[model samples]
Each structure stands twice: as structure tokens, then as C-alpha cells.
Target chain A: MTVDVGICSTDHVNAEVYAALLSELPDANLVGISGESRERVRKQANSVGAAAMSHQELMDAADGVVICSTNAAHKALVDLALRNDVAFLCEKPLATSLATAREIRDRCAESDVVAGMAMPIRYSRPMRRLKEQYEAGAVGELIAVSGVNRGRMPGGWFVDPEQAGGGAVADHTDHIVDIVRWITGEEIEEVYAETTTRFYDIPVEDVNLLSMTLSNGASFIMDGSWSTPQKNSFWGDADVELVGTEETLAADCFGYRYDHVSDTGHGRHTESIYWGADPNNALLRDFVAAIRGESTLAAAATVDDAVRTAAVIEAAYESVERGEPVDVDR
Target chain B: MRQIVAVGPETAVRAHVERYDRFDDAAIAGLVGVSEACADGIGAPRYESVSDALRETDADGVDVCGPGAVHGDALREALDAGVPARCDPPFALDGDAFDGLVSLASDGEGWLTAYSPHRFSRLYDRLRTDVDAGAIGSIGVARIKRTAPFDGAGWNSSYAGISAAADPVDALCAVLAHDADVLEWTFGAVERVFARARSGGRYDHVHAMFAFREGGRATIETTWSDEWTPEPRVDVEYSGNQGRLHFDEHDTLTALRNGGDHGQVAPPGDDCRGGALRAFLERIEGEERPPSAVDPEGPSRAVVAVRRSVAEGRPVTLTEEGSR
Candidate 1:
């Protein structure tokens, strides 16, 4: 069956991904796009031959919806999707709060629509290998995991905590949490976090360090910060390291093409292992495959996952207030 | 367990003592002699006459932080004493000083010297790593900005006083060498640099810009008097078609794609200084030399870049003649 995809909002990374998706998939017709203005929506949906329409009208015309709106507007967008019996792809940190996320998840669950989360990194080859290695005992027993997902501060709505939920934690927690769960074969049972703002003066904490205890006794640390000095230039890389009893495997997620670098540091030196595929394209292909029902949803981060991450975010603010650890309920 | 001996004035010794874990200063009389101490008033290391202390001590290296005038002499003496030596930057005051020391270091074991700590920062190393990993695609543009508030304390004593009294031209030349070496480390040899430097009567508040030969440019602005210290804010702004990369001192990386919010990037740890120092020390232990000073004619090339750029309001092409 031909799929009718309605892209909601053109102000996010997922909007570009979804727009690019329409270009890649000829079978997928982008019937319309909804935004604050007809002009804005028309501009974004122009290349896909889609028209600009009111939110309700666009929802009514589509078989599926892509909710790439700002985080605060996610619940309302999902509500629109549900009213029209449209399955939706909710760009993540799914809703600003767990209650909102659960509300959407429950509503989508009761509908005939298939729902998915925009967590493309999970479908990347390196993460797939990392998951495989964990199961094969390559990273034996998963002693610990660490991630530094930092970037320069960007413009607009992102700087507002009310709109984006949080800073580095809001933007970064998904990929790290997604990969950690995939690698450990367990869930983050508890999390203790601390957040600080040292570099930029954004209202939300730009630097946050989260320590999580997994259900399998493995502990992990995630340091997410937009602490790069504002020097009129480019952004940096996101890195992940999974340390086990026998060996350590690292993924230079942005820089090195999501390649794995292994080190025993005994007699042998580090070796770069290629995962083979541009991760961006890989993620898109996986999303398309899922949309076509050719594959089961390939373990993208759910609203549940984002809510859990937001729980860590909530605990981080608490820790910042109390100057001590606060337990994070998953 | 290793001990370090610093034989210079309190000011000279403080910087070294603060940086190295183990450091001690030898007596002025013990190093140069009684009379030489009377001349400089203990403000400088007895670069020419500090042989006795060098022969007596078993320290790994001696950082000759003496005045510029006597640095060549003190360095010559230290080299003869065979303790393996490094001195406070510039190698010495002029081409002659650097040449003499280069000759001595060429023949000696455990001979390495680095004048500035900024070059050894983790931020730079991480930038180098990203460049190596092809993070921002081809690295079309690489910009490094180092600016600071102007002040008198460090200016009168540390920077201006030393550079001016020695050889104003050579001092700027030496500082340029450090900048050139940094650029060379990331982008290959600087084929050309059209540069300009202005010292606003106040020695500390100097500004300079260098347009590199192959592609891109760099600007270094420093003032010892500004209220806010931008000392901790060295950033390498690299722009590529695919993505733009920012490597700043705070250990944060950021990338912007198709005009959305920047995707956050991970960075190396804060231990890049200690890491570089440890690497330098280990390289010495392994009997390898530190990366050669930018080039033999590096200072002269830098001098040409600054001279021509300052001379002509417009850009100047750095000729192959001055290059190392």
C-alpha cells in the first residue's frame, strides 16, 4: 500500500530526516505538512510536492504522521495523530514529561496505528556490532560504560529549558542510554546524576554527569555537556566506551564513521575496526524498512526510554539542588 | 622520586616550581659565581656561568629561566655539564642562540624544550585527533583564536620586559614560531603566512594575524589588562562542507548539520596537559627527540610573515626563501 506521511513541524533535525526520507522513498507521498504558518510549512514541504495546511486538515489527509515538533508541543502533536488514526514517529525525549509520554504511548497503543521513535543511531552498524559483541562475551560481563556526547550550543528554542526540556541531557541522553541498554543486555535500574553549567550561560544545565547502575550490576557514567567554547567554528564528536572485564571497545560515533576501536593495551596496540555504512543513511534505511513492514521495529528508543532518561534529568536537577545523589526510578 | 632543580630568580622559579611536581633551585653563587649574581640581582638564571651547579646536581633537566642576555651562555654551560637540559622558551634570544643550542641538543641525550604550556593543552591535542580522524570532512577552514584581558603584572615582568630588552624582533619571532608550529601540527607546513603584529605601546596588549599559505588563517590577540581572562578559551574552528567542528579548551565538541540545532560531540578528557607532558617525558626516556622546532628557518619565516603583513596593509605572500 502507498504510505501517506504527514510531517509535522519543520524546525527540528527529524524534520530534515523526514524530508530527506520522502526524497529517498518514492512510494511515500508527503501529502501535507503542518506548522505555525502556511508559508513556513509550504516552504519545508515544497520539495516533496506536499501542500501546507492547518494541523487538523493535514492530520486528516495522512495515513501516518511524523511529529518533529518542539518537545513541549509533542503531546499535542501526538493527540492530533491519534484523533486521525495515524501512526506516528515521535522524535525523541518523546514528550517533555513521563506522564505526557505515557499518555501518548497509551493512546497510540489503543489505536490501529504503528508507532515508532526517531532514534536512528540504534540502527547504525556499530551499535549493532556492539550489541552482538555483548552477547558473544567480547565485552565480557560489561563492567562499565562511559559516553561524552558534547556539542556547541545552537540557536533558538533549544536554549529554552521550557521548550527543549533540558540542555545536554535532553539532547544527548538518548543515544548513550540506547546503546548502553543494547550492550549490557539489561536496563538502567537506577541512576544518580549531577548537572552543572560552567561554559555557556544557558538556563538549563549544559554539563551533566550521570552515573547509572544497571539491573545486571554493571555501572555506567554518561557525561553530556554542550561545553565546547564558542569560537565562531564547527562542532566536535560524540564518543562511547564500553569497558568489560576482558577488553574495551570504543565507538567514535561522529568522527571515525561510527567505527569501533579496540584496545587491550598490553602488548598489542589499539586497532580501528570498520562498521561499513554511513550511519545517517543506515538509520534512514532502517526507518524506511520498518515503515514498509519488511522488518520489525529495530529497537529504536521508545518514549519509555526517553522518559527514563528524563527521569535521570529530573534526578540530576535534584542532585544539583541537594548537592548529593538522588535515586532515578526507571 | 625524581628531583628537579630550578636555578633562577623567584619569579622564574615560581612558574617552574608550580608546573613540575619535583623542583629545587640551586644557589646563584653555586651556579654562575658570586659576582654574576650581583649584576642581575637574582632575577635571571646565570646562563653563562651556571656550570658548577649543573655538574654537581643529578636532576633530569635544567630550565634556564635566566635573563635573555645570558641564556645562551647558561644553556652552553648546561649542555657541557651533560645533565640533559630544557630552558624557558625561544631556545635563546636569537638565531645564534637557537643554533648553538640546537647544535648542543643535536648531540646530547634527553634534550627537549617547550617554552609554553598552551601548546600542550588537551584541547589542541584533541583537535589534532579529530583532524586525524577526519571529523569535519576535509577541514576546509581551521581558525584558532587566543585572546586574553590585558594586564600589567605579567606584562611588565613576564612578557614585555623579556622580549623588548632582548631583541624586540626576535621575541615576536619566537612567539610566532610557537604559533607556526601549532598550525603545522594540524595542517601541513605553512606554505605562506601574511601576518601583522601591533604592540600598542603597552607591551602586553599586542595583536597579530597570520594568513597561512595553503588555506585558512589564524589570529592571536592577548592583553594582560582585560577584566575577563580568556586564557582558558583557545578554540580551533574547523569548517567543512559536511559539518563544522569546534575544539575549545573546555573539552566540548559541537557540530551543526543542515541548520538545525547542533548535534552534541564528545571530547577527550581534561588531562591533555599532563598527558602531553608525560608523553614528552616518555619520549625523552625512549631517547627520541621532541618534534623539531617548526624548522631551522622557522623564526625567520615567521618574522617575514609578520613583517610583510604589517608592512603592507594588504596581504603579503611569504616567500620560500624564509621558510625552514
Candidate 2:
């Protein structure tokens, strides 16, 4: 059966990436797109060969809607889906703050509509293999978990504090945090982060270094920064490493690449190109499969998972403000 | 005798391919670079990448090439297989990993050593001689600037693997680590450090100022831009209370001092890497241990301190008493 997927917005990695992913999945159809901007939504819908829709109309027509708006705008769309009884998939962080994230997750739990967090990196083949190995005791009891999710600064509502909720720390940290939580099944309990605006001139921070403690007492450090320059960086990265008593497991979703050297008559310069299958395709495939009650290829994160990540990020921001370690307060 | 294999990405072990015939004792045989395309070089490709291949690979001795991040695990696998191993600079990042390797090496069956080909080079050998001869007496400050016009460090993720190459520490491990070794080797142990790193994408520029425990200071600046040069251009200058000494990539050394007499000699440019490899093999054979082949704990400590200084936006005491 075809899974009719409607996009809620078309900005940055949401509308464009989802359309590209849907184009690859035969069972998933681009039914419609709903956004605050009618013209923009119509433009995106035309590009993807789908209908332009309002918030409620998209929910009424499609089987599920992807919350692709800015971070702060996620709660409203999720609330709309909760009331409409429409299955919804949300891009990471769940919401801008812990309170809102908890509210959305609590409401979704009370309802019957399917709610999933769009952590596409969970589908990376290397990470999936590592996770399986960890589960099978390839690595003994976990000693520590460290990760990095460095990316090119995506200019949009993401740079705006109000619209995006937070800055580079939240934007990049949540992805790795979710993956760590998934692999270890332990929530991050304490957070101490050092964040600064080193890359861009925007108000929100771009460089983040965090030290966290998991419920199992394993330590975690993350370099979640907008340090990838648009001109030179090969691609964004989502890397995680788990150290156990016996072994250390590491995987980088966007790590496979080769250097491409070409002269454009300017000078001898080298460009790094990513060489691997896109994980976004697998993420959307599993989301569609979960919606259809099929065996999911990559299990989509639930609302509770997203809330846990949000709690860690919220505590991280507090750690940055207070200049010390703070409890995650989950 | 058994041949020692160089296992890592192609470019990292490329020097081994060209100078393979020069080694008298050790033969560069199987699994040179980890890539499939690099199989036809000096050694035949036996395994794919560094993932689990070293756990039980067939080699009497191994050279762990590529980034400094994976050095610990890779070395562990080699030693665990009862194969003596040597690694490229900045041996390992974590103190625990370094200490673990030391403990494993202490077990006696398979030994681990650091690879500093330059230490075996005539150029650095003479540089050390000049320092010993007090050519630049009572050195007050030292500076090294490296500008790589043609080094493909930007796309290092190609061969070094994702786990090794693509972080802000990429330059720190590959570029600055080489210089940090020289800086620490030339000066005494580092007591404190302050560093500032600005990433144009993946941390292409790095600057760090160091204060040595023996009452001297030094500064290091390195840039890995897209400008193409086959070899990285490194310029070193030492300013002293008595005189100054300077050197560049051209194999020429300049020295000047207060009391008049100063001697100049050209350092060896080519054919030294093979000698370095031969010496490393001898060390593996239980001959005299090679210089710069220890735990390299000082450089590792400096790297950790540099990272902390960058994160905290302040100076960090590297060798503080009772500090990890």
C-alpha cells in the first residue's frame, strides 16, 4: 500500500531532502505540502508534483505529515496532527525546549496517532552494524560514549534564536544524543557544555563542546559545532564512538569520501566528495514502513526518545549559561 | 626473517612504496595501503581497511600509518597479534590509550614504538648537532610556520578513514603533531599552552603558543589551504640570547652567534626514509631502540592541553602536578 506523506515545510533539510528521499521510495508518495507561506508551499508542491495545502487540509488529505518547520514551529504542527489524529514525523529535538517537548510527547502518548522523531542518522549502515555488535556484547559493559555532529551553518530560521529555539549546540547535538541514547538505552543525566559563536556572525552560538554523563555512569563528550565551512568542508558529519570494557566501536555516517582534484583554470585545489548511500532514504523508508505496520528497516525514534534528547539539549544550554555541570532534569 | 607491512591509507605509506628497495633487513611486502587502488605498489594488498584486519593479520612487524586517532586501537590489534608495531607521529590522543599501549608493550612478546622518520633524517640529526654545539646559544624563543601549497590535507578523509581524519584534530594530528614533536624535542617539556583555532571548514588553520618548563617560549602556526605543492613548506627560525638559527624545506641551514665562529652544512634531502625504516626494523629485532620511539607521552599531553585551551578560551597548564 502506498504511504501518502505530506511535507509541513520546505526549508533547509526538510522539504528538499524529503522530496529527494520520497522520489527514491516507490511506496511513499508526495501527496501535499503545508506551510505558513502559501506561495512558498505552492512552489514546493509544484516542484515535487504535489498539492499546496493549509495546516488542516494537508492533515485531512494525507496519511501522515512531516513537521519540517523551524524548531519552535514544531509543537504547533504536532499539536495539529495530534488533534487531527494524523500520523506525524518530526525533525529532531522534538521541540525548542524541554517543557514543550515533554508536552508534545505526553499528548502524543495519550493519543493513537503515530509520532516519530526524524533522526535519519539512525539508519547509517556503519552505525547500525556497530549498534548490533554492541547489543551482542561485542563491546563489554559501556565505559564511555563520545560523538561529534559538525555541520555547515545552515542559514535560515535556524540562525534566529526565536524561530530555531537554540543554535548550533541544539541543532547538531540532538542527532548524536539520540543515537547514543538509542545504542546504550541510557538517558544523559548531566550536561556541561562550552558553547561560543566562532564561525558565523549570527547571534546564536556556532561552536559547542559538551561533556555529559549517562544514567549508566558512562561519560559522553560531543563537539556539536557549525564549524564546517560551506566552501571547503566535504560534508556534514554524524560520528559516534562507544568505549566498553572490551572494545571501542566508532562509526561516522558521512565519513566515506574521496578527494577530487580538478583545476578550474584558477589554481590546483582539492575538493572532498562524500561517497556512500544516503541514510535519509532509509530513514524515510522506515518511517513509511512503521506507518504501514511493516518490518521497519531503521526503527524510527518515538516521541519519548525525542523528549529525552530535548532534555539533554536544554540542560546543555543551561550548562553553558551557568558555566558548570547541570542535571539533565528529565 | 619476516617482512614488516605498512598498513594505513595510501598516501600515508606512499613513502614506503618508493623507498621499499632501500631497506636492507626489512621487506615492505603485503597490505601497504588499505585502498584497493594502492595494491600494485611495493606491496600487494591483502586486506581492505584498518577495520579488524590487524586483529589477526599475518605480519611480523607493522607500521601504523595515517591519523593519530586510530593509532591506539590499531597498535593494540598489531601487538595483540604478537606483531611488533610502529606508528606515525602523535602516537595516540588519549592518555589511557597511550598507557594501555605501554602496558601491552611491556608484556614483551610484541613491542610498540613511535615512527619519527625525521628523527632518523640527517637534516634533523644535524639540527640536533647544531643545538648541542650551542650554535644558537641560550635560545629565548622559537617559531615554526608551515604552509602547505599542494598537500591534500583537505580531503584527508579519503584515506585516513572517517574515524581518523575528519575532525578539528585532523590538522592537529597530521600537521601540528609533527611540529609539536620537534618543538617539544627541541625545547624541554611543555608546562602550559594557549591555543586558538579557526576552522574555515574542517579546521584548516591553527595557532598555539607554548611555555616550556625550562624557562623558554615558542609559537607554532600552520595553515593547510588548497594551494598545491607536492611537499609542505615548513620554515623554522630560532631566536636566542646569543644568536639565531633558521632552516626551511630546501635542505639548507643558517646559523649565527655572538662569539663569531659558525659552521654551515647541507642536511640530507633524499634516501633517509629507507634508513629510518631499517633502523625501525632493527629496533623490532631487539637491536638498539630507535630515537623518538617511546610512548611520546609529552606530545600527547600537549595535544590534550591544546584542546582544553581551545575549548575553555584560556591558558591550560599542561604538566600541572597531580594532573592527568
Candidate 3:
């Protein structure tokens, strides 16, 4: 049975990559593509040998919708999907604003709709294995976790805090949130975040660091930045490592390669092979599986998760403004 | 651990394979550069094109230092080839492509990543000790402030792109994520956060607050884009009920055991960084506790919390029991 998908977005991730994902899944049918431009949509669809249609047409034809549009459009598209009674998968950061996210969440809940967030990092095999280790007591006792997703900036909507929802924090924070939530299966208690805009002239933040306590008495720390010095070829990279009580595992979850090539000296270098599978595909596969009644949506990040993340982001900004820790109101 | 075959334009290819000479003999490696002059002394098989590089190398991994525009495809190609890789950061030119790369990495196994040369830095190693020792006593608060100025083209080019356009607080997110080796190595989980970004002259800045799984808290601010006469500096302060730890790359253990000094005894030496790295390498060699690089998911999860904090601007908590 082929699962039909409608990718909705003008962004590069949606337009190009999602299309490729569609091609990878033999059972997935790229029925339609929708975004801001007809030409671009057609190109994206054509690239994957899929059909292109207007957003509404694609929404109506598809069994499930992949909302890859900008943050602002999340509510509108989700509402459209709900009204159409279609299951949906949305990119991380369900919305740019809390109110809008709430509206989408409420509608989905009211409709008893199935919605999954595109927090693909949770699906990584390493993460899955780590979670298992934590559960199995491989680490003796789960202690703590920390992460960084720093890189030089990539301009565009990312520069506009509103569109991208506050730069590095908005872009980088979700991955950290989802990973922690998935790994420990814990809930965030209270949150107080302080943010600053000092690196870039853009309206939003270029660098951000956030910390939180889980319900389990565990502590987590995360940092994100678009600040690495740009080189001739590579822009930036991401890495993930974890520590447990009994054991520890460190891997380049992002598969960043570091090597030394000398022109006049003996060259020594290192590279990485990505053996980890994509969490997004797993996310989509999970969503599709849930829709097919083959499996339950146990691991997927939901609208509620996005809401919590939003609430945290809101508090972080407030904390920055107040120069003090701000409690996150449940 | 991973094999690489250099790929670029014709004149840029190297003739011999360059394995990591600095590390263990077990390590596998590759190189990719644009100039043969760049690849001259490097012992790696350099290809004229990425396609050839993929075909020529039996690498389980590929490190892309290719041109920017083609980076998306380069990463896609590596992942498509079922080869995990560590590419330069800013992962892509836009969010969509970058997100796609992330999606790809997540889907693939052995796909771990981080930016900045600091994760491998010595200071990070030392800091991990204090965190793991619980020396700070539950880490009530962790604060970091990083500042740098743009001297000219050096400052502009290096800091301009994202640092100039994005929030410095986001930079904190990246740093925290990368340095998170300490956090994940110590605490256990992460959650709850808020964030804000603003502009200060040509510099971009970001500030953020976070809630740790337990009762811990963190705040960070990053300043970049402009050049000042003074060099660069970072101030890290960790506070606990017992005492506080002050660290500044150049000068660590600046302030400890103040105001009663936590009433503790027995302090470790300051060689924590080297010790940790040595430990890391030992773990890698299967002679120690466990290697930090073995599992990459937990750290990524911490990063996700940071993203949630920035996106929601409200508290994002982890699902961990009691920590909340």
C-alpha cells in the first residue's frame, strides 16, 4: 500500500529534500507539492518526478500533508488539513507565535486529528540506543545531558527573527528540546532562559544557550550559534555525545568530518561515515504508520510538545529582558 | 573510524591517502580541497569531482569542504550513498537545506555532528570535570558570556554571515550544544528554556535562560561581529549552593569555594581537560569507563531543548521524572 504525501513549503528543505525522501520510500507517492511559487513547486516536484499543484489542491488530494512552510503559515495550513480531515506532519516549531500554535493545537485536539512534528533527530539509531541504555541501566544511573549545534550563519528568513522566530534560539533550540524529551522520556518542569542579540545585525539572535531541569531531577544544557568562522568550503557542522552512569557514547550525530591536509607536511586527517538513519524519514514513516493503524504514535513530537517548547522560548526571552531567571508557567 | 577520498576540481586533487596521523592508527580518514596546492603534501586520493570521490572511496564517511552552493547536494550525495559524513557547518545556505541535512543525518546511523574546533578544546575537557564531580552542587545556575570584536575583513568575513545577521544568543546555543559534552556527561537530561536576540551596532547578540532537569538553571550571552582592540574572551561562571566556579579559558579556577567555600575538602588538579580527553581517547580504545562519542543522541536532545526555548519563547520542560 503506497502512502500518499503532499509537501507544502517553499523552503529548501521542503522543496528539495522532502522530495528526495519521497523518492527514497518505495511505498511513498509524491502526489503533489505546494508552496509560494508555481515554478519553484513544479521544479521541486519535477525533481522527484512528482506532480505539482496549488496548495489547496495538494491539501485536498493528499492523505497526509507535510507542512514545510514558514512558521507563520503553520496554523493556516494545519487548520486547512483539519477541516479537510487529513492527518498531518509539520516541521519542528509548529508555529512562530504561541497563540497561533495554540490555535492549531486546539483545533487538532478538538478534531481528534493526528498531527506529528518534524523533529527528526529523535529517530537516530544512536539516540534510540542511548534511550535503551538509559532504560536498561547501562549507565548505572542516568546522570545529565548537554549539547551544542553551533555554526556560522545562513542568511534569509533565518536573519529575520520574526519569520524564523528569533534566530539561533528558534532554529537550534527545537532539536535540543526534542532530543532531551525523547531520550529521558521526562517532562520539563519550570524554565528560565536569557537571550541576547550581540553577534549579528539581523533582527534576531545569532547565538543562544539554554538550560533546563527535567521532572527527574536531571539537568540539561544546550547551546546554538551561527558564529563559527566560515571557511572556503564547509559552512559548519553539528555533533552529539551522551554520558550515562555505567557507560558513555559520543558520536557525531550530525556526522561532521575533521581532517588535516598539509601542503608541505605529513597530512593526517579524519573523516566520518554516516551510518545513522534519518529521523525525519522515521518521523514521516511513523506518522504514516500511525495513519495506517499499523503502529501507534508513541515517539512522535506532538503539538503539545511544540507548545511547551514555545512557552520555554517565550520565557527565555523574558529572562533576558529582565536579567533574571523567569519561571515558566504551566 | 571513517574513510575519506578527497574530491574537488582537477588541479586540486591529492595523490595519496591521508590517514589521521595525529590520533590512533585505527583511524580512517580522507580529504577534500579546491587546490592541488592545498592537497600537495597530503597523502589522500583526491578526485576531480564529488561523484568520482564517492566512487573511488570505500569510505563509510565523507567530509565535505566543497563550495557552498553545492554543499547541500554534497551532503545529500554522501547520505544517499549511505555514507555518514562531517561537513563544514552552517550546514546549508538556508534553513530548508540545513533542515534537510539534519533530517538526513538523523535518518542515517553513525551520523554525528558538531561545529567549532572547541569541542575538542582543552578547556572544555577541564570544565567537564567540575560538572561531572557535581562540584558545583546541582548547578543552580550556569552562565557564559562570549565577546569578540571585528578588526576589519578578518572580523567582517569571519563574523559577518550568520553572526552578523543572526542573534548572538543563538551562538550560545551552538556553543552550548557543542560544549554539551560536559552537560550530557554530567547531568542526565535537559528542558525548559526561553530566548531573545537583538542587535548591537554591527554585532549580533543573544541571551537565553534555561531550566535543567533537576533544579539547575543556565543563562548565556554571546557577542560577535564587531572587532575591538582587545582580543577575544569568554567568561563562564557556575554557581551552586556550596560555592561558585569561575572560568575564563585563559584563567580557570579563578573563583572557587567563596563565601564558605562549600565546606568541602579534597580538590582535583586543574588538568581536568587533558584528563578528560585522555579519558575520552582511552574510552575510545576500550580501556576506560565509556566513550562520550559512542552515543550522540542525548546531546542532540539537549540541543533540541535549546531550539524549543528559542522558538516558543516560553518554558519548554523535559519529560524526565522529578527533574521538572
**What is the Å distance of residue B101 in model 2 from its true position?**
29
Tens digits of lDDT, candidate 1, B23-51:
12222223232246443553433433456
What would the per-residue lDDT of candidate 3 be over residues A1-330, giving only the tens digit for each residue?
A: 777887877663544766688667766777888888888888888888878888789877888878888776788888888888778878767777667777778888888667878777777766777677677766444444556666566677767766767777777777776677776777666554444444445777665666565666444556665544333123444444343434434434656335444455645433333445776678777877777777677787788888877776776676667655566654
Residue B305 CA displacement from its true place in model 3, Å: 26
Model 1 CA lDDT for position B76:
67
Q: Write the per-residue lDDT of candidate 1 for residues A271-311, one digit (tens) a residue.
A: 33434565655554455556677655557666566666666
- Residue lDDT tens for model 3, B203-312: 44445565555645566555444332234546676655444566763563233446632221212111222222223333333433222221344443444555555555
Q: Model 2, B1-324: lDDT tens per residue?
A: 656677766665665544555545556656734566676644465565343445435566777765445556667767666667766566656556656766676675676655445565566667767876876665555666664333322111112221345554455445666567767777668876666554442114455666678755566665544322224456676654444567775533224323542233222123344545566566777754434335565765676667666566555776443113
Report interface Cα RMSD per prediction.
21.3, 15.9, 17.7
Candidate 1 lDDT score at position A71 = 85
Model 2 docking tier (incorrect/acceptable/medium/high): incorrect
lDDT of 2 by residue, A65-184 (tens): 788888888888898888887887888777888899888888887997777887787778888888899899876777656677766788878898888888887798878888898888
lDDT of 1 at A205: 63
CA error at residue B243 for candidate 2, angstroms: 36
**Which of 1 and 2 is ahead in DockQ?**
2
Candidate 2 DockQ, CA atoms: 0.03
